[model samples]
Target: MEKQVNAKPGTKQKKRIKMNMLIDNFQLATLTLPTIILLGIFAYWPMFGIILAFKDFKVPKGIIGSPWVDPIYKNFQFFFESQDAWRVTRNTLGLNLLFIVISTVAGVIFALIMFEVKKAKYVKIYQTASIIPSFLSWVVVGYMVYSLLAPQGGLLNKIIIGLGGEGIQWYTQPQYWPLILLISNVWHGVGIGSIIYYAALMGVDTELFEAAQMDGANKLRRVFHVSLPQLVPIITIMTLLAIGGIFRADFGLFYNVTRNQGALYSTTDVIDTYVYRALMNQGNIGMSSAVGLFQSLVCFVVLLTSNFIVTKVEPENALF
Candidate 1:
């Protein structure tokens, strides 16, 4: 009590404010502590493994003890020299670009459609139905696709035969896979994706919508001028983030859904699947790490470039 009384006015007020802040936010801090710790353990801690990209890792030598490659970039050079490099890179960029465009459009459309559902019970039902597929494992989805597309006794083949058309070999044909994968990807993701936009729509100002209606705005005009403008920030941020992962692919979706058939490699193979195959077949830690690091670097550069453009075009929506 004496010490508190003796303290300078500024110091005492500062200490009291600090103490009050700590007391107020203590519960919030407790809630986040576990997440922070887990993020450190699982996400941040393993960043040290990035060194494997430069080192010739051996089982006996381990990460730190392994010798660095003579040329340092030899592993990266090996990947770039491989003939599949161009093919995988092209497919990764092309397919990811396609997914981003199609998924964004589909998600936005779905969200808009959902927003029109005024009945709470129906909304819940629709949301549950849409989100269920997102929770399904890709392996399960692969089998489901197989059951439909399998040449022998497949439902789709049976339908085709019933229609007087020949049963098509769906798996071996690369041409049909781009469309099949797109549909599968959209079906699996669009529901969850739309949920984000739907939440954004929920937060939109009711007064703006009311004002739009009063000014002779129809439903379509209101959606275009009011709803879409409100969604621009989130859409920009999501697209920017998606662009960062353009060099990567959903490993399970590509691997399991396609069953890793060599025939589909021309259309379905991506950098992640390629590196996974290389790692599994050769067990070359350095090469795989190099590919991962390359992907990261490309993603980082793309993200920065995209953010720069957004910052210039729409400073408010830019992430950083």
Candidate 2:
């Protein structure tokens, strides 16, 4: 009988493969380590501060050593009891909803118009012009609005007076501010929103449009039937995301644009501004954290619910 020998001649190749995998993992870690470390330090690590919501948090005592309150519901109770709570919450939700609707509709219209521009040079210039406002800080935007609407010397008032019409009280009137806030927000914000939708529109296959035109479809027919239908999924997804944050508002826009005027609070106040004022006036960290946590939880639930509804209606558009 021949002597039987058991051997694994492939052992060297197996070892080499293991070494390659280890090297690949090390490379991945090296590439991603900085981001991971920063997020751990800034985002996840600081989450321990959530405990401040439950404690009678004293900056003096620090978050950990601070005495925990037996009940934290009192903070929320005090908030809900105030008339400002309902007013701010309503304004926040209402104004954001209006912004979402108006900005989306206008942005899509502008994007389609931009897409139709035959001159490429003009198209680039138009795109550049549309996006310039988005680069400005909200503080700057607020000042721009002030320059345009200042009752005493605003551009609009000057124009109206020059045209022999009564110059309106541009800032004091609550009736006008809702319109001003909406328009100003759209003016400052629509550029970015339009750019996104325009980018998406640029990605669309022109073959669809060519085919529709070949079928003797007019420009309006092609746009309404083809272009809009293709953009619906993205529109739906964005709408869902915006709806999730309905409880929040743009702090700077409402705060600065309204000049933080007390009278304007009826129209411009929102959850963010209210919370900021609470922090400034009372220096109550736990109370402020409680408001933040409440807003976050509501947003989380809304996102899930909205995504579910979108999934049911149009699975392709659902975020999840």
Whole-model lDDT values for every prediction: 0.94, 0.86
The C-alpha TM-scores of every prediction are 0.92, 0.88
Model 1, CA-based lDDT? 0.94
Worst 10 contiguous positions by lDDT, candidate 1: 1-10
Model 1 collision count: 0
* Model 2 Cα lDDT, one tens digit per residue, 9-96: 4888889998889887998879898999999999899877777777787777888888877765866766788878889889988898
Candidate 2 runs further than 4 Å off: 1-35
lDDT of 1 by residue, 44-94 (tens): 998899999999998897898999998989999999999999999999999
Steric collisions counted per model:
0, 0
How far does residue 120 in candidate 1 sit from its true spot (Å)?
Answer: 1.0
